[model samples]
Target: MTLSFFDQFMSPVLMGIPLMFLALTLPWALFAKPSPRVLNSRMVALQTWSIMGFVKQIFQPLSTPAHKWAMILTSVMMFIITMNLLGLLPYTFTPTTQLSLNLGLAVPLWLATVILGMRNQPTHALGHLLPEGTPPLLIPLLIIIETISLFIRPLALGVRLTANLTAGHLLIQLISTAAFTLISIMPTVAFLTGLLLFLLTFLEVAVAMIQAYVFVLLLSLYLQENV
Candidate 1:
């Protein structure tokens, strides 16, 4: 989308908000611990894991390369989600909608798949990716489809996130403008639309987190399939 004059000039500066928030805020969020009165990201992830039926595991988390990659993936998802929600603040441009922002998320994932796949199992990964020894006649068709599907993974994730945040922001903007126009900034229609926008704001936050999770999970599953 083409930005307005103000947006054009401001978009570059505004985009940094997410990076700064993730870089600065995330460290504090991670180091803080769970308590009776406090809720932290780690605690929340664990709680969500349990509620989602991943409990009863006794094995300690390994320090293997696989483990590290998983941690990185989870951390990136959380950062993206948090920044997305932050960008939903009134009048702030959300960076998640930018192609550059989503590309940052996708490129690393693609690289990780390549690096970790070979590291985990070289021959088997090749098999999963290529499925060698198929009939010659069908080989070209299968290869074409596989190549397209392989490349589309990142694009899918990026577009999903960018579009969701951008669209939500636009909706809020429209409602906000219409409210001001119709209600003279003083009364009933104003109050109603304002409340509606507020509700949409919260929903946008949830969508932000969900898109991040979907992007990360899809990456994981693709890796898993190849493994």
Candidate 2:
């Protein structure tokens, strides 16, 4: 299983999507942790009238708004961490390991910040994008970088997950593949190599939680800052 440079780049990239985790989520409620969430006016209206029960169905029977949001976000963190752990298995999909999926989670927070700021103070949201304590002379450069970075957080979110997970998966896969290939030729020597993959996978679950926590924590901080 010694791969050339080309093979090194090819294997898991072919499986960009995480199929197994998505399949496991099919009976969504089994994987879902339902809880109380507050009903905003818009959601209240939907709960009262929507045919699909889209508004309140995911929520617990007597949930408040915070309960529901808490459930939703916690479920997402679990989903990502679970998926990442699953991917570490011999053959499984890691949804959070994808750039697209991570961006899907991050971009909405960015959009929400914009909407929250605008709604709170229609004329002032854009102004809040710049640093508050900077000197007037340094204002332009600070504004440019901060604004650009603000916009790029979602992209950073995506890249951060994609890069780290992809690198870990690639390294582990390469190591295991090498061991598997040589195990027949040199049984005793490759056993340790094969075992290392499992140890690393166990370690990766922690990495998954850390990354998810970092994403959500930054999101909460950003929301607090803007809104």
Q: Which predicted model would earn the best TM-score?
A: 1
Local distance difference test, per candidate? 0.65, 0.63
Residues 1-227 of candidate 1: C-alpha lDDT, one tens digit per residue? 84453351135334445343433364336433556755557766675674333111211232333444555666666667666776776555566777776877797787677667778778876665456688889887887877777778888888887777777777777787778787875688788888998898788878887887777767766666544
Q: Candidate 1, which segments miss by more than 4 Å at Cα? A: 1-65, 129-135, 185-188
Cα distance off (Å), candidate 2, residue 172: 1.1
Score candidate 1 by lDDT: 0.65
lDDT of 2 by residue, 1-227 (tens): 74463343232443576344443464343343323666446544543453234224333342242233444555555556666665666545566665666788889866776677678766676776675788999899888887897788889877887888877877777787889898999987788888887798777777876776676556555555454
Backbone clashes, each candidate: 0, 8
Listed in order, each prediction's TM-score against the native is 0.70, 0.67
Q: After TM-score superposition, what is the CA distance of residue 37 in candidate 2 from its true location, in Å? A: 23
